[model samples]
Target: MTTLVRGRGWARTHPLAVDAVLASAVLVCMVVGSFAEPNGEHGPTWGTRTPDAPSLVLMTLGALALVFRRRAPWSVLAATCAASIVELLTGQPRAPVVMCAVIALFTVAARTDRSTTWRIGLVTMTGLTGVAMLSGGPLPWYAQENLGIFAWTGMAAAAGDAVRSRRAFVDAIRERAERAERTREEEARRRVAEERLRIARDLHDVVAHHIALVNVQAGVAAHVMDKRPDQAKEALSHVRDASRSALNELRATVGLLRQTGDPEAPTEPAPGLHRLDELVDTFRNAGLPVEVALGQVGLDLAAAVDLAAFRIIQEALTNVQKHAGPAAKAEVSVVRVGPNVEVTVIDDGPGDDKGDEQRDVEQHTGGGHGLIGMRERVTALGGSCSAGPRYGGGFRVHAILPVTTAKGGTA
Candidate 1:
């Protein structure tokens, strides 16, 4: 089987050479058959008589025409048919030269459409058989030799048509398989891009929120280190706790990128609104006095909605701590309305106006700032989030998230 496959591959690469070899084989068959007498004592007798000079010449021309069958199927078929008809009319005993014509007809049928194959096939079969019969041979018009021409020509057309159909079917299947594989690869690439963006968002939210708190507490510790050691020690303790929490969250976020063969990571679920009290406590410890109001516990919300809600609140309060001036007080409210949960963070600190204008530009232009992240998280959940300066003073961030997301599941 392997050898046969290699031979077929080589034949495909060198088509004219393959046709030359096939023409040689058909010539040998015609020559050998011409030497056999149709009637004998037991069966047909071979070597009793040989093809005459005209018969041999016609056979050679017919076989030679087949060498270019694939290149010009119609021309080759016409040439072979002319040679066969001439030999049938002039030669005493027909030299089976029509075998080359049969092979040419098969090539035409396999290469051309069915309609052309049928039209040309009928013409070739009728023309050869009619000529063979019309020629004044010793045998009758309905002899097996004359009838064999009709039979072999018809069978060749049918067989070639079958080969053409099977080849078309195999080509179509291969094209569909290639298209499906490309679609799967494109889908994989799209999924990878989405995962990378989500991981970046998680990292930004985690780092921005905790680092801001650490910076604030470290500054407070340094300000009163000599004058008020007790207060400074408390501030340093808050800094240590913030750093540790940041490390743990960073590990969980980065672990998502680990391969299967790597060491096992912590299996804890992602943070969501369930950790709201804990999130509020972190900011309170950073010298930012925060007041919290909860209308209804949103612990039963969908996982994505819950996570979006938590991150929005975390980002809003962090912004208030970073952008809103010191001695600023913040109010955080989480209210579960019908079919939705509303989160609003309003700070009374006098926010810098120039910086707020720049943030507005960045937010509109798809910046990676905290407000942009907040809006992106909300938008991904099909919700709306707005952050801007309030009427009289500080900034406010508000987001209304759906209770059940498109791909909803409890956290």
Candidate 2:
């Protein structure tokens, strides 16, 4: 069975060679049938008594036309049918001349639509059978030979139409499979792009916050180096701590890109609302007096919500430190109200017209991306974030996140 399948595959790939082989076989049949006698004494007969030169030539021409059957099936069928009619009209003994016309008709039906098959098949069958019956030959009109021609032509048309239908079905299946594969590839690419953007936002928030603190501490250390050695030492220590925290967070953020088979990466849990105290302490050490107010309504927050709330607070404080004057103070508040956690950071800095415009220009001109990152994180979790200068004299950053997990479970 396997060998037969391989042979058919090879024949499809080399159509010209298969056609040549078929033409040769048909020629051999016609040549041998011409030499046989149409008598009951012989093993079998096709109503032919003796071979004639014109009949032999016509039979050879009809057999040779099968070579081009695939390329021009209608033309080949016409040529073979005309040759067979000529043999019939000349009153020559019957040979296998009509077999070539049957093969050509089948080729046409297999390659064309059903409507063309029905029309051409009817014409070929009726023409050949009518000629065989009406022409004056040694056989009678009601002979079995004429009936065999009609049956054979009808069966060939039916078989060829079946082959065409199967071929169309296989083609449709192959096209659908290819379309599905392309859709899967596109979906995978879209997911990869979203993940990369999320990682980029995390990296930006981590680097901007810690580096601002490092710059402030390093300046304090350089200023008090000679006059107050102890104070300078404390500031240098804070700088070192800030740099170390920055490196740790950067490593964690980049570890997401590591291959699964590589060495295991850091498993430290991400900073969340629970780490609010530590976060505030770091900002206080950087010389920003920040007060925290917490109000609770008893709701467990999801991990993503907890992380987003913490990062929002962190970024808001960082912006206050960078843009507000030296004497400015900030307040951090976290309140839970009916299935939601709201985080608000407000700074009592003199946000005058000049300061607001300066900060706006800096944010728009790429000097800051903290607020943008915060808003994106909040919005992804189906929350809302707003940041702007307060009406009186300070800046406010507010974000509200859902406390429920994404899987419809209470965290």
Candidate 3:
């Protein structure tokens, strides 16, 4: 029974074709009821109301209006209400007309705002109840039949409004869920982008220092080939060592670029501030004079922060070797300040002394990857770095990195 009522209700709520069928069905029922005899012989017979052709014509017109009730609900409601009032005034048995009015009210409430539905509903209820009570010959004002019309019309309007409210609420929840899903996807993309940038920075540091050392050693090997075979062999040996180290580091760094079908990247320690002395010794062996000063250090910094410190020093020395004159005296210093570590690399070399011969070397500096990588690493670990020339002499690279990560862990 409920399913049948719901199906009829769905037909009324939908568009033209279903509404047309519902209207036609209701019209057929009303026409059949008009011809058939009433169950109780106490009231006027259906044939009595249908005796006059004009009354039947008006009744048919009202019923036909139900075909467009879903499309033009207010118009349908007004028409059906007027038809019901006319039937009462003409002293005809109440036509099967209230069904169209009820369907029209339900359509209005479901499609319109709640306030409009309430106002329209109250007006419809009052008008229908008032007409049925006052336009009376046999029925009294306080009769059960009069009150029944009022109760059924009110139920139809309220029920339709309830269904409309539930639909709106469900739609709102679905919209919110969709918006949250989009936000989560965007956040995942952002994290992936940040991780890519970090890998690129690590790769930059690995390639720059190793390649510079290879170039310096290779140049030495070529310059002294005839003059000193023994010296040339040593330089060649250094070049080979640098190349091997570069390859291993390259293998570790480049492993990140592959998302699948690759071995896991090395989690082992890379050289940091503790390895500064070895780094300087390599440059010292390559013919550059280096001075190092290490402040009293007992601090344990974060792995990322230490790695960044190591890269800063490495890049500074590489820059000096490539840009500063061979006779340059480079000073490297690491100072432990409260909650921060400061590293400074200064070289007293003529800026114009190095070769403009290697275009690849010039392009490396022009790309700005070295400095950008340094800054990004420092900033990500909640620190800072700066590089420029000194007032009196040569270029200086200075960095101040935090000893702790953003979460207050030793970095």
Best by lDDT: 1
TM-score per model over all chains: 0.88, 0.82, 0.81
Against the reference, the lDDT scores of all candidates come to: 0.88, 0.84, 0.77
Largest TM-score belongs to which candidate?
A: 1
Tell me which of candidates 2 and 3 scores higher on TM-score: 2
Tell me the tens digit of each residue's lDDT in model 2 across 1-411.
999999999999999889989998998887787776544555565544667888778877987889899888889999999998887778456776888888988999999999999898898889989998998477888776688778888888988899999999999999999999999999999889879878888888888889989988889889999999999999989999989999999999888789979877789988888889999999999999999998873435677887888889988898888888778899999998787888999998985566678667655564557877887888888888887778887888898888774546455
Model 1 TM-score relative to the real fold = 0.88
Estimate, for each residue in 1-411, the C-alpha lDDT of model 1 and write its tens digit. Answer: 999999989999999999999999999999999999886778789889989999999999999999999999989998998998898899887799999999999998998788988998898899999999999478899988899999999999988888888889999999999999999999999999879888888999999999999999999999999999999999999999999999999999999989999988879899987798999999999978999898875457787888888898998898888877787899999898887789999999876776566555655675647777787778888789987778898777889987767566532
Stretches of candidate 1 off by over 4 Å are 39-43, 136-138, 369-372, 382-396, 408-411
Query: Candidates 1 and 2: which is better by TM-score?
Result: 1
Runs of candidate 2 exceeding 4 Å displacement: 1-14, 34-43, 46-48, 88-91, 136-142, 293-299, 336-340, 351-368, 403-410
Candidate 3 residue pairs in backbone clash: 301-411, 302-410, 302-411, 303-411
RMSD, one per candidate, in order: 2.8, 3.8, 5.0
Clashes of each: 0, 0, 4
